[model samples]
Structures are given as structure tokens and as C-alpha cells.
Target: MTTAVFAGVDVEVNEEGFLVNSDEWTADVAEAIAADSGVGPLTELHWKVITFCREDAAREGTAPGLRRISKLSGVGMKDLYALFPKGPGKLAAMVSGLPKPQSCI
Candidate 1:
């Protein structure tokens, strides 16, 4: 793990950049992370996914996969791809300050 500063907020993160402590997450941190991950200037749709991921991870103790995220958020897989690019499940988890989903590569 390593320490990172996002929008001036210091927090610990894993090698892949997922937050070590979910409690350390904030909107500023999310924005910074999104920017760093090439998904910046989060739109309302992005917030919807991010919020759902964070809440679902808090309840499930693990990040949700793309299927769950797509079904639950009512955002189709294609949209998720457009919103996150390359890897939606992993990228969403990272931006949400959650660990990478087990279903992700």
C-alpha cells in the first residue's frame, strides 16, 4: 500500500490505486481519482454509478461486478463502457474508493 493525496486529502491506497480505507473517500477524492483515471469531470451518470458502487460495496463487503452495476444502476453495459472506458467494473470500483471487484481481471 502507498499513501496518496487527492484534492489535498491524504489517504492510503493499494498498488492499483483503490483506497485502502473507504471512510477516507470524499467527493473531492472521487473527482481527483476520476481525473487521474481518465474519467474526470464526473457527470450525473458517473455519480449515479459511483454512488451505487460505494453503497453496494459498503453493504456487500466487496465491489459489485459490471452485471450488478448495470442491472442495479439501470445503466446498460454499453453506457458503462462509454462512461468508464476500457474496464468499467474495475474503473468504477477504483473511482468509488472500493477494492477491485473479484470478477474483474
Candidate 2:
């Protein structure tokens, strides 16, 4: 798990939560997420999907599944699977500094 402050707000996350933000996120925030998620070398596409997942989770209070992520990011499930082969894409998204899921609480 990793943590960072985005928009002057503190964000805590691990591998089992949802993405949260106190405000609309920016590219800098996404970079921070990538650094925290243990994917410091994340590509632009990775940032896009990860950010989308975080925002969606924050809005819905639930982590978006791979299918939703694919839809929002315009990335295929197979491609997402290749990126997160461990089957915890949501967790990875959380680790990138998303909010904790309601279920987690």
C-alpha cells in the first residue's frame, strides 16, 4: 500500500479499496497514484484507466469492475488483464491512491 496528498487532501489506500479524491484529480495526482500503486512506470493509458477507476469508485462508492474499467477507459478486458494479471485491478487502482471502498469500511 502507498499514500499521497492530492489537491491538499490526504489519500490513503492499499490493495483492497476504492479510489477516492477530495476534489477532481489531475495528471499530477495520477502520477502520484502510479507511484503509490507500485507501478511507477505506468504509461499514459495506465494512468487513464487508473484515474477513471478512481473517479468512478469515488462517485459510486464501489470499486468499478474490470468490465466497467474497460468501458470507461476504452481498454479491452484482455488488455487490462495483461496489465493486472493477478485479478485485482480494482485493488491496484486503489493502491494508486483511490479511496477506501464502502465494503472495506
Candidate 3:
């Protein structure tokens, strides 16, 4: 794993690490995730979804399902998949240093 310090936080991540600081994720970290994910700038919609996922995971102790993410962000499955082509969006969110999601293992 590789580590980067952001906002006085030590963020450790893997190659596809996008959600490493889910607990204290910021726009800069989100940008890092987008860049690492090979995506362009994250839209407000993307930030909304990621933020919701992080908050929900922190509160509920598990990564929110696609249905819940969609409900919270008003983003559809297709769009979510397009944004997060990888299987686990939650992982990406975690790698971004957002926080520890609820259902993370």
C-alpha cells in the first residue's frame, strides 16, 4: 500500500485506492480518486453519491448498496457504473480516504 498525507491525515491506499479517508474525505481527495480511477473531474453528482455513501457507511457500519446510493444521489445504476467501472465503489470511496465504511471487510 502507498500513503499520502492530506490535511494532516495519513492516508494509506492500494493501487486502486480512492476511498482511503472516507471519514474525512475532502474535495482534493475526491479529485485524487477521480484521477486514479482514470476519470475526469468528479461532478457534483458524483461527490453527492460518494458523500452519502461515506456518511451512511459511517453511521450504519456497512457500505450502502447501489439502490441506496442511487436513492441518495439520484443517480442511476448505469451512471454509477459508468463513474465507477470497478466492482466496489465503496472500496474506491474508502481509498479516497473518505472514511471506514460500515460493511467494509
Using TM-score as the measure, which candidate wins?
Answer: 1
Superposed Cα RMSD, model 3: 4.0
Q: What ranges in model 1 sit over 4 Å off?
A: none
Tens digits of per-residue lDDT for model 3 on 35-56?
Answer: 6556667777667676777677
lDDT of 2 by residue, 1-103 (tens): 5554644656653344334443435566656655555556567667667777767867887766666677677878777766655444544455445554344
lDDT preference between candidates 2 and 3, better one: 3
Order candidates by TM-score, high to low: 1, 3, 2
- At residue 2, give the lDDT of candidate 2: 50
Taking all chains together, each candidate's TM-score versus the true structure is: 0.94, 0.54, 0.64
lDDT of 1 by residue, 50-93 (tens): 99998888888889999999989878889999999858978999
Candidate 2 least-lDDT 10 residues:
96-105
After superposing candidate 3 on the true structure, give the runs of residues whose Cα lies further than 4 Å from its correct spot. 5-10, 14-21, 87-92, 95-105
